[model samples]
Target: MKKILLITILSLLFFSCENLDDGIKNSNSPNQFSQNFGQSVQRDFMGQVVDENNNPIESAIVKIGSNHVNTDSNGVFILYNVNVFEKFAYVSVEKMGYLLGSRSLVPTNGINKIKIMLIEKAPITTVNSGQTSEVNLPNGSKINFDGAFEDENGNSYSGSVSVFAYHLETSNSNISELMPGMLFAEAQDGSAKVLQTFGMLNVELAGASGEKLQIAEGHTAEISMKIDNTQLATASSTIPLWHFDEENGYWKEEGEATRQGDYYIGNVSHFSWWNVDAYQSMTTLNVTVVDGENNPIPNLGVTLTDQSGFISSTLTTNQNGNVSGLIPTNNSLTLEISGAFNYQEQIGSFNSNSSITIVISSASVNTFNFSGNVLDCDNNDFSNGYAVIAINNYVDYAPLVNGTFTSSYATYQDTFNYSVYGVNFGNNEFSTIVTGQADINVSNTVSINDLVVCLNSNTINLAGDFNLVVTRDDGNIYTFPNEIIQLVSPNNYKTTTTGSWAAGTIAQDQGYNFSINNLNGIIVPNQGLCQGYYSNNIYGENYNGTSSNGLIINNNEFYIQYTITFNTGPRIYTCHYIRN
Candidate 1:
């Protein structure tokens, strides 16, 4: 039956737009209609429309993009021929006595089931004169409208009146239906009681239609109402008088009501819904800060700011991890809680009258010492200098005046090392070599183990044929011949070779190979060293399998030491080459 109804509606709709310029192409037959839209692969989008209470809402309009469908008695709707590959469809719903709802639906790849909930509109309550009516508000409170009144020569009398009260179902900048701490109170008769009651009066006596009263220009009428014992008991005390501003849809503060024993008396100058509330009452809130394990965290800074943009307060938790404050009733506030030293900060919103507990997590701290010493090539302290350790891109430096320096910093817990380079400014006489290793692990404990580095230099003057003799730790000796060792001058600053030569030697005694005046310089091995192995340079760059070496000249002797570890133990290899 629904299918027939849909086809009929579609046919009628198509015919109605036949003459329009942008009308869809008209189909003369049912087969043509099917061919126009039924050729594509079809998928069914099934869903049910439910009210806020999960009850099915029948006759609601469900629209998917340009397509429209109406829910059946069960509030179930199915859209046929929906393209499954479309990925997303914009769905909107409309129903009488309910707020319009919308949701974006993503096809479940295989499943097309969806559930959409709609909020029902609050019933519009209207009360007539000289009678009392009880209507339940959407927020679970019940309001009783008692008798109406008219002032006849300053005497109160029962009169005809029209009163309208509606709970604004939709929220806007002007009015919000949900107020914090607003709830149904128990009455003396075991029924749900209202926070307040209202009694409206006729503003005028003449020129008014039935049940309606007209007020004179430049003048207004007042509503006289009584407070029942149930309301007073629910409030637990006296409350201020207020009127619901029908024009503005908000509660406005009027003068305080005079509590005459059991009844409170107040005056209203205009016609609208009147209410008695304790908005001015002080509401207390208790805040507690705790860790993830429920342990109390004391001395944490907590701040509360009313979302209404008026009030703010700051306090610190006591030893019990609790802090209490009083706020104006029915307010929502944003709470921010923070602490020092390894505690994470948190911020959220809460009702001002409610007690809440906030959780703070503990953060792990990492501490390590970055220490090393700056020295000369002769193993002497290079006083007054600085050294830096570069871990990835971050750099940390410490001053080394007496050849030793130490500094510490904290980082997150991680397993990593640093690449360090040290330079000593010997009063601008020379600079320490930029040399360091990349294997210092500082993940768990304090580290201050130092690596010795040579920084001093000497001048070289002799370059000639040199015989190299190697000695192992076991006193085994090996010799290599036909090796060319070059000693370059200071003016030839660019050298790319390794092996020891002569330093600080005058050309008059040693003969001129490279000129030098007591300045230590580097050695260059112009040919390959031992088959195909080239020495590693100062920079940490690898070329094939060739490794470079560093040399320091001291005590008029050449000291070259290298370690080769094979499986179990390290074999120290030393080489001594002489030019005479």
Candidate 2:
């Protein structure tokens, strides 16, 4: 369904008849999203979703392989025991008010943490379907449509048409994380090629009632994107345009755009995330991230920016502490790790493939790593087990190999507050998990070993639909009826194969997520009905109350109640799920 809209992500440029310009600056600190995932087992994947502002966004749907999950109030979602292929996975996010966001990454084992920043949709511009109309951006970019629009059913739309348009500034340093996938595209001949973008635009249309609409058959719309002044001297007179296939997450070469003065003007037969980009001559660039000890760092954020604004995107290091992608062979580029924009250097040589190694430095003393082993209820070695490891906010899985496992060792946060649990996979049922934790000043590689565990408990299926209600301190009540929920079972937690859990919340417009432990109804940490004060802010109303199995609700239903404390007072949210 998200393929229907063009996700105009990046440095925001809202369209208007009048100029509304905004300037952007780059920071050495975190720009957009950051990933803290450690060395992980390859079976499960999890992460958080955030908006362009970097705050956690709840209810965003995350799809990977054939599994999907909704972000909890904390913007955290997990997929257990899912399938992955050849070290890479495709991840996509969908929220109502934001454009679709997706990426391709070499996934870590369990607890593959990534923060995806969804670009909020700009306000719609209304135009008559029967008359020519154009929406101009602040920077002089515009999309001109020559009347005659059609609804989704192929019927001509005669009334008002709503246009949603956005332009992405390629000059921004953070463009690596802001754009849709890496600078890669499918050529007119179906071969994949790396892209060096000149400019990008996403155009979308809806009818009077918000149903999908498009330019009439055999008609076309002209897209004019303003070229950055800094690039005009080097910009080509003519460029091939590419359109992103939102459904497949691939950009395809579609049409051509001619550079006119300061803009690239093109006529497009259809709408998608269109880009004026040229195929770059690329060679494989392998980046290895390590610590002072020369150990590999897994899941570290790596960004490659073509100084000329031709190629840019962020990628994460894999389990071997390596990130391998095609980079422009002829252009100079900058490579930064984990949001450190200050460190810039030429990565590799031209023409031939190259490998570069970099170290993650800190103000600390030694390396930081995770390693451990597991035991069963009778103190027997448990080979078929997986461990959930959390060091501060860096949560991930450490899969056991013959009852032992090791993390990708590297520099990490100074204070290592940890929590670990070993889940039994011996019988495909997680009756219990061995749990442990401790706070330590992480000066060097920390290994957790000889962990005693057992299948001491079980979990119930809390998957279904229900009504979620939240009441503010001043007595304002909001009710969301029929919120959907799903929970996959284990030893392997393969919850939903194709379906997505969508809950309606005044706080979480996207929805909420949670996994219950039948042992004590202790839901995953901060995974309950927490939302932000804003629409679906997961931390808005944290459950200060006790836990429930979310079952045994009058025998015919189940429920979850939470109390949130505000500066003014307190409010209670009773998410009462009525059974059929």
Candidate 3:
């Protein structure tokens, strides 16, 4: 971890005293549709924070990458044109008196909406380090401390250790909205893996002065959770214990838990979001979101329901209007998308990499199309940018290509009271917003001007499908109908973090996504910044198999491809990827 992350008492106090509506707010608005390839692709996310009782939790600090926004009074926050990499996006939220919460999703090209539920962080009781104590949660989960405690510095500490604990039931319908991240786990071997949860626990300790504490060097804490009856039917005698890495958003396998009767008992030497989950074989699913007429839809909510009834957090479509993520192989799953109408379909037992299209009808909703141009501060065509039209608290983000942009929106607003904003990724610059009122289903021309598209060198966001063609030594060719990839760029002036590909999986192997390090821009002379990588011999699969060297982008009028050559023991394969 390059940065030190902390949840400070000072921040809690500051938030408790600050106004709730001081920052970002959101309202449900129709998604704006636009096709943006390579550098011009944009990703947006909107979601709400709530409590166990389904009440909105407002003013929470929500963050994705360097962009952070406070939830509005309605517990809604929308981040337009956010920075997200790989196939997944990690979002963390914090409030004054709640357990830190986070949700991870595979963001689509345009609008990705999700929901998060935060548990309250109140110490049930204080235990003295000099005496052993055991506490049981209301849900039959139990925790035991053996009279040993230490500060984070490893020194013997200790008067009273305040313990904050919660048991996460796998059977809860809303568990998807409350879980930290997807079932992905970072195994001890550093391989990418997925998980099926038996149960989970959130444990945290605070010193006498509210500072963080941990278990003593030679001590361990025991946790026992009652496995849900449904999960118990298929639960094994032993399960691997994993802890959440909040900073990286992947579960880290550590210890193991043994089943005893109806409970799973585990011991941990440290505290974090610990879980009892077993690795599951997974394949990738490329989801296309569209209306009944086949018009690509954006910001539509799609929820996954597993065979065991374990529902997944809802994900939204991006500007390119699609969703992509991992799904358990040979497992029955159902996708449910809600609008004026509810569309539910079961993707029968899926065993390999594939794609699914969900057609949601919006025939009764008011749909409108708007066209405009995104210009520089001097009112010239601004390429590599996005135009925004916000009404009430809802926003529409349209890609600006060579200064021109077009979008379609579905809104129920009586009259359009909208505002426009733009950004040029070529450089870290923003435009002055244009505000006005318009009629529904009426043609409107919008010009979002006065922004600097500076002549600078930097990385750019990558989205859409990359056509993959692989030819093995045996002359056997494997073709992936489409290879969807995401690379969130580093906004030159705002962040120092270099961009990298987020993990994802495909058909062949267990899980195919790799953690390719340091994605720096490779600027081709006379050509725009399209793709990049700074290291070689990365592990796992970039397209199909492992790459012995880092990727180099080849851009042309027809298609942009990355020719990767690598090996697996005695087998060598050459893979060429073009924008599909």
State the C-alpha lDDT per candidate.
Answer: 0.40, 0.57, 0.58
Higher-ranked by lDDT: 1 or 3? 3
Better of 1 and 2 by lDDT: 2
Candidate 1 per-residue lDDT over residues 1-580, each given as its tens digit? 0000000001001001111122112344423322332123344455656654344455579876457787643355656566422322435678864555444322332224445666544334444545665544333333444444444343344444433333321111111111211111222222222232221111112212433243323443333334432244333344555543332112344555555554444544544344444433444566777656665655455655454432222344544566654444555555666444344333334334456787655543334456666666666775444455555444443446467765544344344555554443222222322433332252333333333344334323223334556676788876644223332211222211212322211111121121222343222323212221222111211112323332425323243444433334545555564542
TM-score, one value per model: 0.22, 0.61, 0.54
Choose the strongest candidate by TM-score: 2
Best by lDDT: 3
- Please give the TM-score that candidate 2 achieves against the real structure: 0.61
Backbone clashes in model 3, listed as residue pairs: 86-502, 109-318, 109-319, 110-318, 110-319, 111-318, 377-450, 377-451
Ranking by TM-score: 2, 3, 1
lDDT of 1 at 137: 39
How far residue 537's Cα lies from its native spot in candidate 1, in Å, is 94
